[model samples]
Target chain A: MTGAACVLGVDSGGSGLRAALGSPEGAPCAGPVRSAEPVRTGPRGIDAGHFMDLLLPLARDLLAASGGGRIAAVAVGAAGMATLGEGLRAELPGALGRELGAERVALAADAVTAYAGALGERPGAVVAAGTGLIAVGTDLAAWRRADGWGHLLGDCGSGAWIGRAGLEAAMRAHDGRRGGSPALRDRAEKVFGPAAGLPGQLYPRADRPAVLASFAPEVAACAAGDAVAGGILRDAARHVAEAAAAVCPRDAASEVALTGGLIKLGEPLLGPLRDDLAELLPHARQVPAAGDPLDGALRIAGGLAADRLLLPRDARMLSVHRSEGPSTSA
Target chain B: MTGAACVLGVDSGGSGLRAALGSPEGAPCAGPVRSAEPVRTGPRGIDAGHFMDLLLPLARDLLAASGGGRIAAVAVGAAGMATLGEGLRAELPGALGRELGAERVALAADAVTAYAGALGERPGAVVAAGTGLIAVGTDLAAWRRADGWGHLLGDCGSGAWIGRAGLEAAMRAHDGRRGGSPALRDRAEKVFGPAAGLPGQLYPRADRPAVLASFAPEVAACAAGDAVAGGILRDAARHVAEAAAAVCPRDAASEVALTGGLIKLGEPLLGPLRDDLAELLPHARQVPAAGDPLDGALRIAGGLAADRLLLPRDARMLSVHRSEGPSTSA
Candidate 1:
């Protein structure tokens, strides 16, 4: 008889992708048990085939490490998979099935796993703002989404958005259309190049984050005085709070869980966001994403097996007695 | 006797410093009116003695190039010399005298020169936003004022300020404080780096345009649907217009001239700034700067010898010739 079976959960992040495997007890059966990988999924779009190619081997390695030598179920969360739809979903499981011959594969939005990670199997909202911003939640039926319109349309409160705003401000200052902020101007130039000396070639080839994220520290630096940076943060916080409020369950007390690359930078942004949320949504509780999203995905994986999403025999076979295994973490 | 003596006007720019001999007709003389030299002043602050080093060579070159070996007059409109006061006035001429002998040197703020170039000795406000920003006007006397507070404090409507604001907005969104704008987010990541990634390592070492300038196009892209970038730009334009209004002289019918890299990037910022100015200062006339700040500086060089503070004969000769010298267009 197979021991305690486990489910694997995978999360693709900005810096890297993580995987985790766990049992019903919320205990890990195998690995998380991995680090992040940098895959450039930008406006140009990720090569779904290439992404699958990269992931299957990792999954196989994770499964081999599991004691049961098999993963009963698998769920993955990705960063820029907007157009993936069923085609991408099918490719995920099909690749895994061909590699390990696993029993079942469930594919959901990265936000779903993040939501599960934050709520730990319960219903809640997860707003991930990194290179992009997507606010997601779960109700009795389908997953609910308030925003995530891509860079051109939606995603008001995101690192990319804020960074862009800061850069624009810097440019305005540089151009004299705006006044001047020494700290901001200094910060941008320090990161990219001398404002006055930027080469025509460099402007077109300039990377987004290399130039945009450079101003983040300046924003915090100037938060004490630079009204433009401060105002941007304040306004962003209001918009984010509004987004979370939009999908938050009307009846029950909503737990708004925030995650992603931006929050880690710390204060000015955090303080204002918190204050703004409190003012905007009295009933909702604002909190930092508990652990990494991978953990949430793992919990979801465990819960799925425990809650009869998988056959009891399959669960048993995939769980327990593991030296190492496929990841279950969100 | 001396091959038709001439004056040289040197306008120090962000890309490099340009030395020119302008005729009274407002044309540059000789070959290569402008040449590449390192930008001496920026938000980060000036080089230790870079100012003197740049000015000295510029003057010597002008003398050597002039058929009128005896430069009649020397007029200089240097950027960031506002705080230098008479000390700059004294030091610049003194430095030139060391090179070509202490005959005549007419030095003034680059802002004044820009005024002459754009308004042709008329009274108006010239707002220059390059890597930094300042608003200057030509009244009966030379007027100088610092608008944007070096990218740290002021700079209401500058690129750096806008970029900083956009980044802050992203962070707020990450914290569940605000909504998200994908355009801003994608642009930030492209310009700066992945959200919350290792910022210290990711940021460029030199002062660069805010990452947001990269995404500024996105703001315009999303303006039809995105409220965040649009709102940010609208507010930025309004704020910048306010600064211009504050600096424009009350005595004359205020003609606000817009000049900067941000404006060249296209709409979002420019259109909104123009609209905001119209709303803020109905009486003020908005006009595109007739030429770049360097041109303005050249104009100042010509004017200083002819009008305003007087210069010696040789200095005046240099000015008229420099104005007619070969320019970038030539």
Candidate 2:
């Protein structure tokens, strides 16, 4: 069934989900895709079926706007898909077919799409560092991940990780338990002011990692030679390098592609991370992602259609299915 | 004139001003001295004259409870005054004489008492690390200070400084700009919740630094082996050592004392700081204050009266000044 074939891609994260349609170049679809309220993914991330339930109606609305033309395919790249394995892989395709009346559905981790978008569905690794840090790689059909231990046990090379480190320094400096770096001390007081005392006030609520993660750039400035702040960046880079190395598979063609907010520390962190990773994996190739993860998902859909492994409408339907597959209301 | 004479020591921080009366053995005076709202010192750390203005009346109140007997003499060690010259120092005596009707008033920086509290008023240095940091030394009639830059330019080894450092690290981690310790991020999320993403909420509040400062122990913990956190503490300890060495005149004769909330980091920071200082000045002496700074002030007052410099009624009037000075006005 192919009539003005359409494809949809959705990228959901801790805060919200973003969906787009059309070709890999960010071309607009013939119709509109509906959006819904942001659902709290919790500490473990979002549930796939529940995510599909939320997205299906929105996908239908978009397809219905296509003036009665059948949707070709649907694909989704979401934040929490890494936590799901084979037992859950079929959940998405089944839900999308049932909910959106689609002919074909493609299920893959958001990291897969991110990898695809950044370097196309090729052989490489993607470091998805947002509120947290996780390194993912694809060796054709096999997928591997490392360092997504949330904000507590792991996530050494993430925004949250850096933020948490910064907070500890500030606390020590503020109490005079430790001598403070001029740069780090200045940034904390500039943002929080002098009256910011009392340990409990530093974290009266939850989601502190996100709060601390917000100051990543400030630390970058310090790391760029501001004596007090430079160490923070230097240390953070080391953590990221460890994470990337942890996920690199032995005897695989490893092309490391960096993603996420923490890389903004630029040279101070990135340069060191590169040097360290090279020391560990002498033959590891560093690849920069060209586009976002959703684009990678779309590219995958396009390639499938081109290869006839999936039909044009099948690809379009799969794309639409991805947008609506996570929240399939039970 | 002397009817069971007692000494009262007052410590005024940004949070609150508390007065305590007791002996060097840690026994409470016949009655509690007094306490009041935190007097705004206005950054440059409260001038000697202004301190007298607020303190004299409080002294009188405390003295009045002595029941018409002498308070022996009054000694006040404030956060500032170490940098004040003879002219500024003279004004304090006049202010106390006129305001509280005292014959003797000894005005100096809390560093003096902090040091004395740590080393019994002998020649030594006290690292006064509270909301701010000050390294002070005393040699007979002269006093010297260094590294108490308040919250703005200096305060290298202070609670405010550490809090600021932690915040910057967390921000970098949040934005994915750098990897950081897991502390500030988690702590911040706990304090601010969803609003933790909003940096403004973590700053410029009464409890921000106080809350952040509470993590001094964490910095110490991390410094012991927490990698990212250890770096923060080591950096701070170095700063504190530099500040201490800078203020202490002769390294051979200098006794370094540690005070303030930062000291709670215990041996983690202190041990490293001592080692660092040893490298800078092998003969530099280190010790914890025998008690709080206010207690040292009382001891100084007792010593002054024992030497017959102040009449008995002078002490009584100082007590009256603290308790009845404000109320007698209207």
Candidate 3:
């Protein structure tokens, strides 16, 4: 006989996609498969066809390796899903049902999954910072978000924001202007070549945010000795905390967590970030993230399979679709 | 005598190309012929072939329209000439000599031309604030520039910068975050459709800087009653003045001038800009621009033709190339 039914969870982000298989009890089963290439987004938002193409083979491999079981439910957490998820919401459910025999599917914004993974249906806020930064909160009632405006208009305290600022300081140093950092200039020239050619190097690329974010680590590396670089991180920290405070629940009992690749910048970013968060959101209890976005996706999948989901649903942030029949069993 | 040996002057910018014919005495002789499309730039930097294709026909048309003057000299001022001008510097002199029978050619950064138009080789700074912001100064020795790093990195206090700040405020209002402007939000939604669709509309376009700059006037328009919008402009003025201060010569008699399309925003921008300029550049005299960039190009061409060009030569900022042999006369 085939193994017990399993749930599939996938987290798609700027770095790539991560998928895991889990039991209804939230225990990991087969594989947390990863693909380093992010799913492409197009005119229709998240390209459902491209997503399925990347996903189905991996799902099949996970299922086969785990002794072949029916997919009871599936959950996908994706970047840009809040604004650009029309394609995924409309097509993912039917496609999942047809291909994986999933009777329940949850489509969620990556922030929502980040929240689920970090706090697990609790009433609080979670700041997800990577190439971009966003804060999502739930009093277990409705979702609130701030920032995540991409590299152009906002994402103020994000990796891209820090990298762009660092590069700007480098350019200023090159031009012999005030507020420049020679240390950051050296780092930037080492990384991106001469400061004069930076605009030509950066502006044309379609993946400009990622390209900009790639330099964030360099900024962090220079922060210890360079006042300008350190100032950039402090300002970045303030913005990040402000974003979190914007979306964090005001209740004293609420918890806040910080997650994502930016935390890897470590103490230079985190030190000011902690101070800012304390000053900005005094009522909330700061906490460590319990898990990652893929784990959150898995948790949501397991919750959907078990009919125990407690997170609030929103049309864009988190939407659930059900197959119009009784639950399938292995 | 073919119209007393007139010179050719061309201004290539974000808006388009504008060409004029002038006598060696710096008086206009023929049409300021316009081409609505800006010359295309490529990986090799400021496509020389495309520039020639656009300019040759226009030069011929201007010559025919003005009774066929001998092109004694040609000067072309282009937007990215300070950096992305290798292609132009390499091929323009030879081509202009062969096609228009021009013996002298001056290729200048648009800011250099703007300075020539505004202050005319004097010891002062000129802040050229248009779609992008750049301040160029000269003590009649060498050019000093601040900002002009393009829309992505710097260009602080630029049209694009102001418009981006306005849009960010609009997005903040949409997200119900602090520092949001509902007035700006209403304006943005009207101009760009729903708040949610902005990233989709903007980030893909190659002309993002121009698109962002298109809203700067709206920001200026709302500054009268809206504090957030007003704040944005005030900050813009500060940045503009800061750029000017960064490049301005620290001499008691040095002059400063403001030039470019952004001047049309009127007193709302100018009021604060005046305050900041007066405070930051107290040593320099403030002056109105005598003419636009096309006039500056014409002046440079005239100067080149008469062998009286006084501006310092820089390989990237203001390069001049002369043909071998004696000067060709009409």
TM-score attained by model 2: 0.56
Q: Native-vs-model 2 lDDT?
A: 0.58
Worst 10 residues of 2 chain A by lDDT: A309-318
lDDT per residue for candidate 1 within A17-115, as digits (tens), equals 677667654456666645556445534455456666666667667667775545666666666444434344535555665554445565556676667
The digit string of per-residue lDDT tens for model 1 on B143-231 reads 53435444433455566656655654554444344445665666666665665541332243355344434444555555556688778
Estimate TM-scores for all models.
0.56, 0.56, 0.94
Candidate 1 residue A118 C-alpha distance from true site, Å: 0.6
Each model's DockQ? 0.06, 0.04, 0.63
Q: After superposition, how far is residue B271 of candidate 3 from its true place, in Å?
A: 2.0
The regions of model 2 sitting more than 4 angstroms off are A1-7, A14-16, A22-116, A119-124, A130-132, A137-236, A262-270, A296-330, B1-5, B10-19, B23-116, B119-125, B128-243, B246-253, B260-272, B297-330
lDDT of 2 by residue, B1-330 (tens): 345555556665555555655542333463444455555444344555555556665666666665544444466665544433233354555554445444445654666667666766566567878667777665434455555644433566577667656554554454333445566656545555531233435443556545556555545555565566666777778878876765565746667778877788777677779888887656767766777777766766666656532211222112222222222333
Q: Pick the winner on lDDT between candidates 1 and 3.
A: 3
Superior by lDDT: candidate 1 or candidate 2: 2
Better of 1 and 3 by TM-score: 3
